[model samples]
Target: MIAIVARSENGVIGKDGGLPWRCKGDLQFFKRTTMGRKIVVGRTTFEGLPPLKGREIFVLTRKPDAGFEGATAVSNPADVPADAIVCGGAAIYDLMIPQCDQLLVTTVKKEVEGDTFFNFQWLEGFEPEETIEETDEYSVVSYRRSGPSS
Candidate 1:
């Protein structure tokens, strides 16, 4: 499975329930990587984005009914495909990182204000494989787990 996300240099992924910066290339990269794949996301994260058509969205929520149209609500990561793409808000990222075989991350060059953050230290578990300069403000990096599939 793969985990995809974009965060500021300071590791901020969200502010007031949305991305703190807008990078067009990162947006396009997200679309291309996740297209036609099953995407697992948290309820809050899913609520902020528009419905993705070609991808199946699985939302992790404690609520009995998320009421999100066109998406399935699941309580745990084990309920989805082992190969699903883990898209995020901070909590969901933390929950699913150990299950990820690969990580596709976009690093925004500047620090931005955010209430939610992910500890990028988890990236240490993966070996860096590729880095692409998607834009002047951000870069995309891919990493693969070296020893075992978590």
Candidate 2:
């Protein structure tokens, strides 16, 4: 039940520790999907997050104990919670994407100036199962990991 959640323009997700644009819709979507989920991310992404009160977080870093309250670091992605939400600073998502079961992406309509981008491709068996249309700014797409072929 793993999921990758992100918002981007032309596959680029961030710049200067902030999202390149403002889209309230996409922000809410990101919140809705991730709240209460077990979230796994890197140090930078964790620092970028707004205060999360009760959510469980696992951060990937060389410093296993280098994060705020309610977060612990495990060296690799395999040890994360089953229905983990991989939120990111790009590198975390890249390392964990292959084992991810679902992806929730918000594709911004405009190209952004950024230092990070999502480099993972939607695998062969994944289905573009859900899409939230052509908006004034971006589109929200959910890619689900489909089961074995018929």
Candidate 3:
């Protein structure tokens, strides 16, 4: 699976249930990247954003019967596609990171107050394959697993 996220210098991704910063370009990047793929996301993350038009949305929630009008409800990570894109709020990121094969991150240069974060330790088991300076405020980096699969 692939994981995608945006975080600040201090690892902050959200504040008060939303992104701490407003970056339209990053959102566009996200949309373009995941447009034709399957995505696994937490309930809260699905709720915070509009439905992704062409992608299959898998909403992961603790509730066994949780339902969303346009999404498939999945209780376990095993229910998703092997190559699904794992998008998130912090809880989902925590659950899915270990299973990810690659990570696409947009890192904002400044630290921001936040209630959520991306906890993946970049250097532990991954190596950067490419990095693009998307803009002055943030840059996008792609990382592939460096060692054997867990």
Candidate 4:
């Protein structure tokens, strides 16, 4: 599985339930990487997103029967397909990052205030594979699991 996220220099991924920064390049990169893939997200994250075309969305929620308009509701991370992409709202990332084989992270160049943050320690098992895209505002890096973790 692959996990995709965008974090500020201070590791803030969200602010007031949305992105801390606005970067068109990062949005484009996210769309290109996740198009046509199965995406798993937490209930809160899922609720905040607009309809994503060309992708199957799975929401990790306590109420699996609550029926999301255009997404499937799952109670466990294990229920998500191994080939799916794990998107986040902190809790989901904490649960799914360990199961991911790769990570696509966009690091915003500036620090910003936010209530949600990503743990950098999660990347310890993964090694940088390449810089997929870079600009003055942000850079997207791909990381693959290394050693026994893979």
Candidate 5:
């Protein structure tokens, strides 16, 4: 599985249930990368999203019976497919990061206040495979797991 996220310099990924920064390039990059793929997200993240067209969405929630429209509800991380792209709201990332073989991260150039943060230490076992300076406001980095997979 691959984990994808956009975070500020201080690791802030969200503020008041949404992104802390407004970077159009990062938004475009996310859409281009995840389009037509299966995406796994936490319930809160799923709820905040606008209509996502052309992608299969799996919402990880304790209440799998809650019946989220237009998305499949999954209770366990094991229920998520190996090829699914894991998106976040922190907790989902924490749960799925261990299963991720790669990480696609967009780092917004500045730090901003947020209630949720991503731990960069999670990337410790991964190595940067590629990095693209998308714009002055942000850059995208791809990290692949180093060494052999267990």
Candidate 6:
């Protein structure tokens, strides 16, 4: 599975359940990487979106009127698409990491003062290769299931 989120140094994922930064490239990387694949998210995450395009999203929540017309709702990560991407907010990442094959993380150089931060071990798989990193605030990196693609 592919999971995405922007976390801070303190592991503070959300304050009132919203992202810490406005990383457009990170968001776009998320969309393009997981496009046509299944996407799983929490209710709060769902409520925070601005109508995504061309991707299948499943929400893991227990709210009423639980459906997005074309999207699916489930109880947890396991109920998400087999190879779907578990899109963020820290809650979803915590639940999905053990089962996810890899993670696409956009680590911003500047640490925003926040409550949630990305887990270092999540990127430790296969020796954690730096697929993409720029001289900018955000560094887009990907880790493979088997580590470094050998």
Against the reference, the lDDT scores of all candidates come to 0.86, 0.73, 0.83, 0.88, 0.88, 0.68
**Candidate 3 global Cα RMSD:** 1.6
lDDT of 2 by residue, 10-123 (tens): 677887766777888777777777788788878887887777766788888877756566788887666887777878767776677667777777787778778877675644
Q: What is the lDDT of residue 108 in candidate 5?
A: 94
Stronger candidate by TM-score (5 vs 6): 5
Off by over 4 Å in 6: 9-12, 63-65, 121-126, 145-150
Query: Between the candidate structures 1 and 3, which one is better when assessed by TM-score?
Result: 1
Candidate 4 collision pairs:
none
Between prediction 1 and prediction 2, the one with superior TM-score is: 1
Q: Sorted on lDDT, highest at the top, how do the candidates line up? A: 5, 4, 1, 3, 2, 6
User: What is candidate 5's lDDT per residue for 55-149, written digit by digit as tens?
Assistant: 99999999989898989999988899888999997999888887888989999999899999988777878999999656789999999989643
TM per candidate comes to 0.93, 0.84, 0.91, 0.94, 0.94, 0.79
Which pairs clash inside model 5? none
Q: Over the stretch 1-150, how does candidate 6's per-residue lDDT look in tens digits?
A: 666665544555565567777777767777677777778887887887777778787887765367766678787555677777878766777777667766666665555666556666665553455667554656666666673321
Which whole-number lDDT from 0 to 100 does residue 125 have in model 6?
55
lDDT, candidate 4, at 130 = 100
The candidate, 1 or 6, that scores higher on TM-score is: 1
> Candidate 3 residues 1-108, lDDT tens each?
888999999999888767889877788899899998999888878888765799988989888497787899988778878878988878887788778878899998
Pairs of residues at least 3 apart in sequence or in different chains that clash in candidate 3: none
lDDT of 1 at 19: 93
What TM-score, to 2 decimals, does candidate 6 have? 0.79
What local lDDT score does residue 4 receive in model 3, on the 0 to 100 scale? 91
- Name the runs in model 5 displaced over 4 angstroms: 148-150
